[model samples]
Target: MTDTAEAKRSGPNSPQTAFTWRHAGLAAEFATATDGTLRLVRLDRPGSTQRGGAVDARSHDTVAPETALPLVELTALGHGSGWSGPRFTGTAFGTRLAYRGHDSGSRAGWEWLTVELHDPATGLTAFVELTSPTGLPVLRSRVRLRNQGAEPLTVQSVSSLLLGGLPSPDTLHVHRARNDWLAECRWYTEPLRDTVADIHVDAHQHDSRAALALTGRGSWPTDGHLPMGALTERDGGGRTWLWQIESPAGWRWDLGERAHGTYLALNGPTDAEHQWRFHLAPGGELTTVPVALALGSGLDDAMGALTSYRRAVRRPHPDHTALPVVFNDYMNTLMGDPTTEKLLPLIDAAADAGAEYFCIDSGWYDDDTEGWWDSVGAWLPSPRRFPDGGLRAVLDRIRERGMVPGLWLEPEVVGVRSPIASALPPEAFFQRDGVRLTEQGRHQLDLRHPAARAHLDKTVDRIVGDWGVGYLKLDYNIVVDPGTCAPGDLAPGAGLLGHAHAYLDWLFGVLDRHPGLVIENCASGGMRMDGATLAVSQLQSTSDQQDPLLFPPIAAAAPTAVPPEQGAVWAYPQPGYDDDLITFTLGGALLGRVHLSGHLNRMSKHQLGLVRDAVSTYKTIRADLARAVPFWPLGLPGWTDAWLALGMRVPGGASYVSVWRRGGESELSMPVQHLAGGEVRTEILHPSAPDAGTAIWDGDGGGLRVALPRTPGALLIRLTQGAENDHR
Candidate 1:
């Protein structure tokens, strides 16, 4: 037997059959040998010239007994006890048993495959589900364990996904990111052996346990580390495998060498790692968190496939296509201190600058006191802030100016001094030991309770239905440390997971009832940013970094985790800034959801013109944004890059590029992937300064060479398909 086996299934005697699932160039083949030996025969983008390139081709299982690999790598309790990789322990149970049949089907552009395995001794049946969309190069997977026997079973750990088999183990690079408070999505790519191989050398010395793992803990989904990672074949043909855990609780993924091949195992929470354990009573079941695995020829291709899949999974909303420019009175403006007098002029100025939605962010309900933070939860108009005609007058003024009115609401928590705190019983809040949990002077609301849901529904309906507010900026400020413990049965972490799901359910219900309303998800500036939350919310606040200079990198890297149309990038062009600075700030947001802020009312007529110009440019490119895929000219941005570029390529042969020159060289060259080896007409769509920069198409290098004679400049370039692939 050879590493590259011919495309064929196992012999008739083998109960293990082959399943070759594919979408375009991407293909994943799984085979179960006659002896219940399951192996991932293929997990790569098959070459176009390969025979049986069809997505539905039969699996190629030709590995000998010595080379056969286990379908699952990790074992929980008694599951997979005969597996080769690391074993995750529990009270009892492992997957050392025989294989059951499988169920598979396809519909609505998606195909689902589920394999069942039973540990006859413990009567614990495990089901593994793999789902992939028609055009996406990715597959989503999760594991479910059911207790079929009369006795209850205590489970500790379960693999969310287990994938074995890759082309090679030589020189494999692990690509991941280290995320933090202000700095988010900073990526690092290193050798797989360097990251996890040496961590357990003593235990994995002469075995297939050379493991590398990445884990995330706490309530903030991406607070410690991003829920995404990638593995690339350094010496092989640019083959890349990417995975992301969409769980909000503790999650981990491991890459290891096993059975002359490589394997990837992903899971969320375990009794061994996160003190997470659950009891599955007779006829009860539990499921692991969802994880996505993608295969592609290159990083960009893999990321693009994931991006397309994201758009398909997100909750459809008009805001996605409309791409309305939002003006929020917070950053560089009111700063959570909005008043009737202060907002009236800004509302008028925002409408003049073409802002479609004017959001009164924060302090709108605060009764002109410093203790407002502890007095929230009661979403009512403040008499002191709106002395003359109340908040309705300001909201009416916004509608009169031809823009939708939006309000800021932190509905997840109630303030310690909030009237609702005593109004609702402690059962409506998160409790550990009969006492409500409080963080940062805020009490976390458990949406699993009907009272909490009713409180929020009433507040939102009053503001939107009664006052005609069409938008809501929902913010989550504090992290619910540890988690809540249910009275007797559920773990604290399990309680937290239930509450998170219920919160999202409430959000979906709001959208169901209010079909025309738009909601923005903000968590003290992207702390709670994840696909699950974004699926329900209309927009994601990229960050809360007030400095305009530090915003470009975040905006540039946002598309890796979020869609361009849903990523609300703030463009705060203040009256005090020069023309170039204003344009630089505005350029950071031109390619994403333009979130306008700052003191627009105080800006001069000339200064206001820049805001209007950027808004006008946004309107022109917005329609293209809804259908665009992101591309990076200079690769992913670092914390401080002198030159950063983000490109959005639409279906047609047209593309838009936003370049920011923080402060460095006058001339810089960036290679555009789409325009490579072709000539394209390039023009600056939004010029930050009168003499911003000149973009020249370099045919020889296959890149757009930009020359900016001035420092701190920005340019939005439009590249159109050229006549002949010419060079100048």
Candidate 2:
């Protein structure tokens, strides 16, 4: 449905309805309706600073305008009235939006802009906040809605943001990713015309409007697809814009065409499609999930902007810079079955191999029973598995080897058979209609309740304080379906969203209390990986794919969604594997957080030595890892790509490259963006013993020729640009 009605413009000097907020190259202008509906007038590279001339809604004020958009559309449910229409009326734009006011500020190196709007009839106020680090070409947005009416209101849907007037709607392409357990981040780029029927060829000049939406439902936040999208002009300016909904719950974003141009709409928890609704009483307020938007020259540039934005918004943690090597006992070894004897040797071997943290993943609290999955909430150390002095004996061994000891915890759900299920008050758990909501033998906790928060707080404190544990692997393994219904005034979606906010607050509170503790965020691996969780957690487990051969693409593409320092990719090198296979597995992690695993204790001395060498190489390049931007030499990796490459450009003129050869040519030229027209020298940094391969810099082609004699091999190279005389 396209609306061709043009929006009325304000005066030349001061746009009564429009306001501009600028920060260096990026500028955002917002238009407000007399009824208080807010619209994104312009968001793009800053154009001219000239005054207005009928304010061409299409062109920015600047002479060399980037991309300019019209008012972003809104559609939602109204209390007494029904659904909101395409155009705004005094009280018709869904609950009748009204502009209140706006505020802006800057702190440290970040700038913040907030706009306030409300619906007087419904007494619902919406506050939109945009935050960005100074000079960064991206911004993060979040919305807060408050109900001030005398009666309760049912908010069916609300937008995190809506941007319109995008350039070249006809030639636009949408890019996003499809995610599953093992095959995560499988990205696809398709033309908007192809996805929407409106753009199909009819030889007519009619503006056929079409819409395409990407959404994620339920608790496995990223189960079906990533809450992210991108739009690029295929034949026009070629400028690309990307966005991510930083929500761990239901989220939706729509790309559509209207009379003005293309538009992008971002929202969290809707009633029409996602079964999400909220009941807001007088004086009550609910905050929407955050959404991040980035604009750059291309996909890589936009991704780079998002990367920097992720780093800026995340909670400051020492672990980000420390970049420690972690040894987990789950993949290729242990596999959830752990014992004192099995772990002691592994801990000793991990320490000797230079692992900084040793995590006893899963099965730790399980008794020797076949029904461990359903009987899991107590979190107590199993007497049978740790017959000799309990689990602490092994923890002591990990500390004795100078490594931090960590434990795996799936804290969100409690098993029905577990004693904790009945121990806690009924009000602490999620209840629908009158029954407690249970899924797969596990019950979800409503974090908004005091008792639920207390239970989790006690668990974390007991483990961190009494046990002297310094690291935690927090995992969430279940989906809560649509949501939990609040007992009285709230709907199921609102109740679930409330719990989500409280859960993060609890996580952050845990961090505030245990300042030195490091938390690794995992949800069956990479499923719950979003900025909201990653902002508070120290590291993110990229995936749980056990096949060494299939992990290269996942590890390589992790940086697209997370920072390299926080992307914990598993590097499990087993004894049965050949030297080439070991290098392939270990190489996958060298560019990101090196999460070391596998049966190192069972490996031969020679096999263990290779692991040690890889660890040493990681440590040398880790300092640069903290302040590096990722670049793909062979483009984004395919799930089964023959060759994959990831480059990290550091502060200095040097770049670190990690390349994997699964089943490709012996020699392939990989391009390096930064070293385009300069004389550069490249050196292999890993597999120092047996000749793994070599890299030769080609300044003319602006790339490096990498040659590996054997297939299934890998190489890590450091590239530095300098003249022959300037070289050491």
lDDT against the true structure, each candidate? 0.76, 0.77
Backbone Cα, N, C clashes tallied per candidate: 12, 8
Which lDDT tens digits does candidate 1 get at residues 327-384? 9999988998999999999999999999999999999888835668988998998999
Candidate 2 residue-wise lDDT, 1-728, digit = tens = 00112222233233245666767646776665433455665566555342111122345342112122212223335442232333111124433565566677667887777667666666667777788777777867877877777877666676776665565356678988888887787777888878555654345554444468777877777888888888876864547788899887788888765443566778777775567777667897877788888887677777888888899889999999999999999988999999998999899999999999999999998883667777777788999999988988888889999999999999888988988899999988988887998888899888888988888899989888888888999988888877887676256766677777788899999999999999999998988887788899999988999999999899888888899999999999999999889988998899999999998988999999999999999999898998898889888888878888988888665788888988868899988876798888777888774578878887889888888888788888888876432111
- The estimated TM-scores of all candidates read 0.91, 0.91
Best by lDDT: 2
Model 1 compared with the native: what TM-score?
Answer: 0.91
**Every model's Cα RMSD, please?**
4.5, 5.2
What would the TM-score be for candidate 2 when compared with the true structure?
0.91
Kindly report which residue pairs in candidate 2 clash with one another. Answer: 35-98, 36-98, 36-99, 47-62, 48-62, 48-63, 69-165, 70-165
